[model samples]
Target: MFSYSILLIAALCGAATSDPSTSTDLLWPLPNGNTVGSDMYSLDSKTFMFVPAGKGGSSDVLKEALERYMKLIFLPSPVPALASSITAPMDKLTVTVDSSDETLALNTDNSYMLDTSMSMLSAKTVYGALKGLETFSQLVSTNSMGQFQVPSFKANDVPSFLYRGFMIDTSRHFLEMKTIMDHLDAMAYSKFNVLHWHIVDDQSFPYTSIAFPAMSVKGAYDQNHIYSQDDIAQVIKYAKYRGIRVVVEFDTPGHTQSWGKGIPNLLTPCYANDKPTGTYGPINPTLDSTWTFLHTFFTEIARVFPDSYIHLGGDEVSFLCWESNPDIQKWMKMMNYTNYAQLEQYYETKLLELVKTIGKQYVVWQEIFDNKLEVLPDTVIHVWKGGDNWPKEVYNITKAGLKTLLSSCWYLNYISYGEDWPKYYQCDPLAFNGTAEQQALVVGGEACIWAEYVDSTNFLPRTWPRAGAIAERLWSKTDFSDLHSATTRLHNHRCRLIVRGIPAQPPSGPSFCPHEWEE
Candidate 1:
């Protein structure tokens, strides 16, 4: 745990010159606001009322979120009577939306207006109201006199893109449900609406399937690491309340080593010197049993994850094992497939069809594009591994009229030394030179935290403040391009998250939150 003593020391050192008037400039995501005056509205910490009006479909969720933020931003009881006596009258923080409909649909108009003069939030939908609440919470800061207050301003805000997301790969290492929820909370705070959960990979299959219990029993890291169906429901419900869509990823074909352990002969048996090499290839794409298992497996997945889109990981298909398999080679000769890429195309085509049958659209890694596989127009292309040619690949994919999400520039797992977040901040999903239509094909992007090098303890700090950069880039105006300005706001945002109990590391240098120290 981080010590509040350091915060106290830092606060005391800066107290002599600290100015509360600057709070107006501290809002993250930089809302389009016109400052009405150089005035602030002080909150009577002990008596402020959080009223939810309009009975929006997400009224209950909004109410809970408001309560949590209120408690987090305000000082607890037991303050000196003298301080209480001098505080302003309690102000009503009213959150009003046109409707309470909580349907987690894409492009649901998360645009909101916050009127500081009226202390009210208005939005077309509950999702927008939730985003406005986050901005409102960020606007609150403590005065030198130690009273919490919000700067008086009127602002309108909306996400620049529809799909600001973060992907956490859990298969490499099982993360606790608590840890997952903690990340979701942080995502909500940052205005990230999508959680692309890479639930299964080569190392382990943590999602237990009732239809195929052996999948987890034999493939998981251990018995205790599996996520029961009930656990899945709990996570989905939790994310839903925070206005986040949880898109589950069950990586297939290539990263299915764990699956073979649970269901035998599902993998191609690689051979050496005409003898079984005791190693397996990608899922036996040539087998009828493989299709049957995949159909059943994906049917369960579709039921588990409610999001309209599923990530079908079709990346890094190493064909060495397949080449080593005599059966696969014979099949290739028989099928007249000129190359291994064609075989992968065959598998992906089948999988995509199966997913469509399950009534869910699919997102695949850039390998699908590389393989030149013909896919439905609605399929989302996740651009992750294009190396030095990444920009070209993204441009080409969009030019070809395919909707794409760029993750190549935001791979958070590639850790480096010092202030690396600016790179992520500068990565614009629409940065490429292209026609307006091509650019529009760029739906959004995600900060992928591949868990090969992360777990619960380090994942939070490593993910945050940095991922927050991408969140801002994806949400704020495309013209908002001042790195220096963004850095100052990001610094403040980091402290705000810390004060709210998220272990968000300082993006660049030393930082302190007075409220945390005071608490």
Candidate 2:
């Protein structure tokens, strides 16, 4: 059953072996522990085995993951290597996974060990098995031998952080479902576990809300440009098998122009000399209906998105809108709320309390604490502003005994003419000055692509390899800041991404990915 290509590879200069696309010794995100041997295994003879662990094992999940990888690891053939004889294909590789029942989550165990010597993959849960499978796929390459092969190797790998996150703002511009799924596939390959879906904003509300079904019809760019309820469920299901947690972010109060379109009066009316100015700003905090709508709205949100934590966006609320509104001022004066800061605090306090009552933890932008709001101790602060001042913010947030995550340096939307990723790749999530306890309060960080100028057409290339840099920082033990061997590995990983169907852009100047990225 050998194909013509396989025969051509076999017939290439007698006794010649093929060189790998790159040094196979270099692994992306550098494993915590690993060693490669001179020996190789023929992937052409690859077979699978699952030792059924009775308690939490899902044989179907393991089998499906392996089956999916069957095509992913079939690498394109390369040139000759070592001028040697063809290596005989090995027998079945008994891949045994344990505790496969653990659903992917923030705290799911994802450590795994893969050893080709015994032809074994050792993982606790399906999440861990998925991670192992990605690594194994990276190991497969070609040679003059008539088969695809992976060198003998053993790797015991563990991620340094629990929340290796990637975010896409679909509201700024609509991205097709297939595009999001492609990014998810690449995320899974890079060991990223969280999808911070910023699903709605001022420009659009593309998420179809079941509780408020008319929201998309009223707020989305068009009837055809929205993600239906079924679309979301399919996204969640697709992510689940690949071990990614989907966290939908319905950013509120400020980035909510689209929300008021579906439900008018949700936003405060701007005023000039106490006359309606035909403009709106943040959500109207003084309205009882506002609170009531939010209660019902988030009640549905809590049910729909099963993530333990939800992003309650408390960012960029303009005080000018409230300042110009006399009724809000009147409400503030009656409550002795001398300032808009107090008004914001009052609104957030209600929202946070309701979210707590609904049985979910919450993440908010750093502005909540910066505004001196007395938030609950369990709140996770997302530090995204301050630019170079990010370290100070991270230090201050952790110093205040609140857990924090940094996204300041990882915004992938800001681009330059050449190689902008090194800046992002070098920015360490833990680069701030802090003590052991203060530093320990840092859980993880996210790389976000806000999508103002991004969409399905250019999303994959712009995001891929660059976001992979952030993933490495989150997962690896060291930052790899020196970029000695790291650059070569990154270049190779970019090619791997392209070969595996991510279509990632080249990492740096003058590189190849088996072939140039075709449009």
Candidate 3:
């Protein structure tokens, strides 16, 4: 449990707030977007006639449907003045979408144009556009009359990185589907395009593998926390409806303690004082059954997660078991492998190849580079070690022509409010110590929330606003790095988040009870 003093300090130090409402709003769509075409309006009583252009029949349909629903609901309310006043406030807000071919006309007091030529009828594409619209609306604010308005701005914007992501570590402490979906809603709100689900780890295996029922059934927090096949499909469907890609990371070889403890035969054992230990150690890299199990696991995961990338965690393996086993050592010597590193490489490379056969891109931690494993085709490396200097190790991997993801600047769990987030926003993934060609291999990175001491009570507030900062870093232009301006905007954003039901950690400093805002 976080003390009030600690929360206060974090809020003041990090420029965050204690309100979960703000945190929830950090990801939901602004009221204006839904209300503009509907009965609900901004506080200013501004009205709009949103005339969407050719092929914009769908928007027109949604607008009419929403308006009708609003009228129906408001008709019964005794305080018609409240609904009427609310509808009048949105009068000035209007959007005339030109579908003559494909274009979005944002004629706010400020004019903005978006190239929607690629827009399609497919649910995924529509959901993606809606998700973008939600984030775009979050960036807008209201005038004195409570009319939502965007700054006079115009830019043809597209995401620099294809995979703007957040990885929630569920293995440490399981979060319910409602909580997970809430996080997903938050991700969509922040314009985070990818959800890297860390489904398995050393602590537990929360993924339900139908092909191998023994995996999650034996490893989860009882059976309820296990994510069954149906649950996985529902999550994917919901995420797709919001234009989010769900990527699954099943950590292997090293973080397999839960799996090994459950199915002892599937694990490579360690020898403690000359006795074979049942716990997971360096996996039997050359074992035939190991390959078979991994193959089945990947196949099952591939069927579930639609995203093309699969994270095969190749980080942190102890070599005590390999060093002690005489048979393994004899085999290693016979294969001309002089050290344990080579054995690890053998495991990584072969497993990657196996995953490739199943048609999935691979992502690994920087430890893969440290271990000097043979490079897999189209691999992405997530660099976690944070500091002022980019490591020579990361450069070596990118220099060798592999794409990299920069997590060094994006660990949300570092627990700073805005201090660390702006740094993450300022550090360009393409501005590394390698050649432009090598740097071009930078894909993207995520604000990783390692759920060590977090659960439903604290996770949302801890992650938001800061995660929003990182999201803008990944999605918007780098020039949005002004700390002072961001702080003021963030202050309002905190209030907005509160209204939206986000439990974002309040910005620290002096405590002002929210009720006092009116005073």
Candidate 4:
């Protein structure tokens, strides 16, 4: 963290800075492009038309997204009484994509080119087209005369990482469906491809399981707080339309108190003085019924969430609880297990196999790697806590030949008072000093919005702008290090979000939106 004086100086310097007037490109995730000049492509209600470039029928998703973008960018809020007088050359916005099939699959070819020379956007898939549309929308800004226009430029953009993601922990606080959808909308605008839904935890289990409905019925905050199967389907469908994949996380073993309440004897009972205490530990790893229950439960989750990956949280398992249980201790002794870490390894091994059996890959937290647990090559290790040695944890995990995603640098919930997003912006996923081969195993990172200090009212503001920093970091080039330039672009992006009905706070210090202030 930089000192207060340094931050103050940077803020003051940023405030006095002007937009890059000579450069027509104001993209958030800076694209790979060559700027032409200050020429502009102007549009009005009557002049703008979204057309397909080729033979196939138009995509409903693309059409709807373009319409939304048109209204949000062209139609100012509280509508100006003289708006009808605006005019421009009859301009056509053509979107060309190779495929329009919206299967909600993981798409890595999100490369798109916006040729202002021809007023056209082209991509290999609808997913890329959606990303291109977002960039195109951001390019639309006000001219000196207050008329909306997109600067003329040709941009070829692609993400720096394949799995650009944002994780929302709904277990600590049950975020309403609308809140989730709103976050999804923001993620789409930022070009995030994955939504890591931490749906269940120790506090509550909001996912209503059809195989075991009692999980949510007994564990959710209340009857109305649970997300029915339909709600999950709706959220997934909504994300699909925006080109985002929803990955459900059913945190296990450690964060299973909610599950224990839903099902009796599922958790290991703790013991004191050789007698059963009135407390319980995590799910009983030694019990055959535990495996049965998990198989049935995750089988249902696999059926519901179409994504090929499921997060089985295997972090923070307290060995004290396992040691307190006589049955677990006895089983450990019989199995020749010397420590509780070994028992955790056994549990994780079984759970990983269970997830694979259900035809899905598994993601676990950094603790799995910290404990030296042997994980399969396919198991993705999510590094959240780095202790004092931040890079070492990721280095160890990646060097061991396991894929990793770094989240230690982007915990959005751990907020300070002011100008804190730059830290998130600067923390690169590949910043860890590692060899090229080791760094290649690092896929991407997620800005985690842990729900402990967040809810519907604060979650949107708390996540946006800050999460946007992480979005740009993960998508743009690793060497793109110009904090002054980023501050200006992010400030504009925050206001842009607000205009679209997303209450995103300014990235840093005091700021004002031209449209909002004028209106």
Candidate 5:
């Protein structure tokens, strides 16, 4: 029992404090408006009321306001329904959200938290208060069946780490704009704040390059596979509105097969054949003209992407190609370099310095650290290998005074045998044994879904719920819940994903539930 106007007016109120002895009956209120506010139950009076706030505000902000409001008034913890069946008075409560734009706004005590990024997430991503609207939807509704009871609990949640990221590799397979947008919504709902767009690689170059149109023409699978400059701009605009940062990547040297397709001389020949190596092996890092080409390419990228970090991929470069080339070998001895690793170090350092000249930050795989080169100021190192070996690398890199982003525990491409959700959940960003200084340098982690095994068809079901585990790890404290409860909750989360248009099948095999049958 809340009056509609009273509920809407007290949007900023806190939760209730009531006696535990008496049990009050809470029913699923009839859905009335497009917008819904949290229930108002006064602790002192022991009366319950439902209010329908107008729909279409930042769900995150709305949830926060309501959560704070609920803390003052005692009531069962709110759980958003997968779909809103609320009728009549609640018809006005449905908020129309823009799943593509990047700006998200919510007021906490009248203070605004606005996200300005390139790809905005939907309420599902919980990019901000907009996702909070889902909480609001469930707060006013009671359990349809008595199997689930809303509990009375208090929770104080803020992001545990700052740079929660998700990367989309467009090089191997070219995904449609809608597919990318759907993921943006999903990531935001899961509270991910960074979108690492791996735009180009050796396999293919899907980006439309103005300075090098030949790159797209030669490397892209087709004209449709390429993302026009305007398309990229649109994605950036949408992400920013949802408070998501977009980090653009151009994997150089090793993963530059397509780059070689665009510029033939930039590639290194095979060690024995002296013939084109295609997209495989080491690239011609010793070429002066290569640096000139990179300078122009990166300069253009810097002008387009607003994020501080630019990923110059420095992984998987073969040593034979560089060590065998007569010109490279001559240059290495003349430059007083000892081996191939040092030569790679020279290339990485020069590229990093070139990026620095443009006034942007640098991020590369752990290989850069393995090279033992002098650290660039404020560089971010991403750890991708599995287990202790990778974790140890993160420790060493961060201890040496560089920030780190963890991808070791979050590779979604590893696909679940039964369900990998538990394994992903138990991963601790600060779990390794290290000094306080080393721990502090571990910035955050990301859940990555490399495209080798995924496509638009099954990507959502495979990623979600498991990715949700990573989202919680990134957003909540280290010592959260155990795997059992997380698995159970994941079973229920399937319902929520369906409501958000995600094709997530039920956990208990495809045949257990009819909802899993949906295409």
Candidate 6:
């Protein structure tokens, strides 16, 4: 806390500095390859064509992206026309995409080239073109002449990592569908391609499973809190259109408090004096019905979520309950399993195998590896343990040939005063001393803001600009250092987010938006 105080005090002194929309700073997740022009330019009839190139054809996806962006580009309403025409207003703006495949995946390309001088953007995919349009929208600001101005520049950019993830836990506190969509827009604007949704946890179950009608009804905070099948489909469709993948997590074995509410006889009973005490623990692994239930549940999940990977959380299994259950102990003894870890391994193995049978890969917490569980090759291990030695953990995991996503330092839920984002921006996945092959195994990283203390009311203001730092950290090819220029640039970027209606709180100590979030 004392350490963060120093950084926060530093932010207090380094408030408002520059408007990032200016030619000098003109972008967020600053383009990897850029050539900035000295002057700003205005456009003519304010229409941008979002089109496909080569053999690709038009679709509703492109039309939706263009329509949404046009409003963002001309935010606050129609820009009043000048009484007298100014010099060289462009008549058209267009972006051509090479691929019409809008199905986003682990390998989907988001590389784009933006030539503001030609009023054109080109990309290998519509996702990339969408990214370009976002950058172009960020470039809109009034010049000294009080007219819509844009910088003439060329930007060739590609994400440094394949997966730039932002995770939100809906179980801790249910977020409305509108709130989720708002964050999707914000995530896309920041070039983050993944939404690692910790959808259900010990606290609540908000995902209304189609096969299990009782789950949400019994486990959710209330009937109104559930994310209906339509809600889930809309979220998937919305995120896909924005080039973001939604990876849903249902933490198991432990974190099953909510699961117990819906499914009777699923959890292991806590015994007192050899009698059933009525209190239950994690799913009973010894029960064949447990496996059957999961097989049926995840079969439905696989069909519902089209993503290739599902986050089957294998973290923080409580030994207290397992140790308390004599039946589990007797089953363990019969199987010659000496420790609770061995029992956990049995459960995880069965679950992972079940997911594979349904033709879906899995992502687990680092605990699965710590427990010596043998996972399939496609498993994405999400590393979440914190400490200075996290780099060593990543090195070891990648050295073992398992692909992973780093979230050790980007836990936004662990709030501290001051510019904490600098630390977040500093924690690079590739900074570890590992071989090129091991480093390549680093898919990307995620900034997780758990929802125990976060919700719709304050999620925006509390997360924002700090999360933006994470956005740049994962998206840009720049090294993980918070430079002096980056401070001002990020501060400016905060203002950019505010105008775009994200309500990003100040990453710096204090700041003002040129155009406030409301208008």
Task: Provide backbone clash counts, one per model.
Answer: 4, 5, 36, 0, 78, 1
Best by TM-score: 6
**Residue lDDT tens for model 2, 1-519:** 121112122222232112442234336766668776666656553453334343444566676777787777765632322222334454555565767465666779888898877778777777887888888777776655546666677889998888889889999899999998999999988889999889999999998887787789899999889998788888887887788888888777899999989997899899888798899999999998998899898888888788888999899889898999989988998999988999999989999999999998989999998888889999999999999999999999999999998899999999888777778778877778899999888888999999989999999999978888888888878744656456656766777776667889866766445544544
User: Per-candidate RMSD vs. true structure?
Assistant: 4.8, 5.0, 9.0, 5.3, 10.3, 5.4
Candidate 5 structure quality by residue, lDDT tens digits, 186-223: 67556577888988887689898889899999998888
Error of 5 at 275 (Å): 7.5
TM per candidate comes to 0.91, 0.92, 0.76, 0.91, 0.74, 0.92
Let me know the TM-score candidate 5 reaches against the reference structure: 0.74
Q: Rate the local accuracy (lDDT) of all candidates.
A: 0.79, 0.79, 0.59, 0.78, 0.60, 0.79
Question: Between prediction 3 and prediction 4, which has the larger TM-score?
Answer: 4
Residue range 377-411, candidate 4, lDDT tens digits: 88889988864467888888878888898888788
**lDDT for each residue of candidate 1 in 227-297, tens digit (9 for 90 to 100):** 99888999998898888999998887889899898898898888888889898878889989989989998
Q: Candidate 6: where is the Cα deviation over 4 Å?
A: 1-13, 16-24, 45-52, 76-87, 480-482
Candidate 6 backbone clash number: 1
* Model 4 spans with C-alpha error above 4 angstroms: 1-25, 34-36, 54-57, 77-90, 105-107, 144-146, 515-519
Q: Sorted by TM-score, highest first, which candidate order results?
A: 6, 2, 4, 1, 3, 5
Say which prediction, candidate 5 or candidate 6, comes out ahead on TM-score: 6
Candidate 6: C-alpha lDDT: 0.79
lDDT of 6 by residue, 116-159 (tens): 87778888888888888888887775543556666667889888
Name the better of 3 and 5 by lDDT: 5
Prediction 6 TM-score vs. true: 0.92
Give the C-alpha miss distance for residue 318 in model 6, angstroms.
1.4
What is the lDDT, from 0 to 100, of the residue 112 in candidate 2?
Answer: 87
Give the 10-residue window scoring lowest on summed lDDT in candidate 5: 22-31
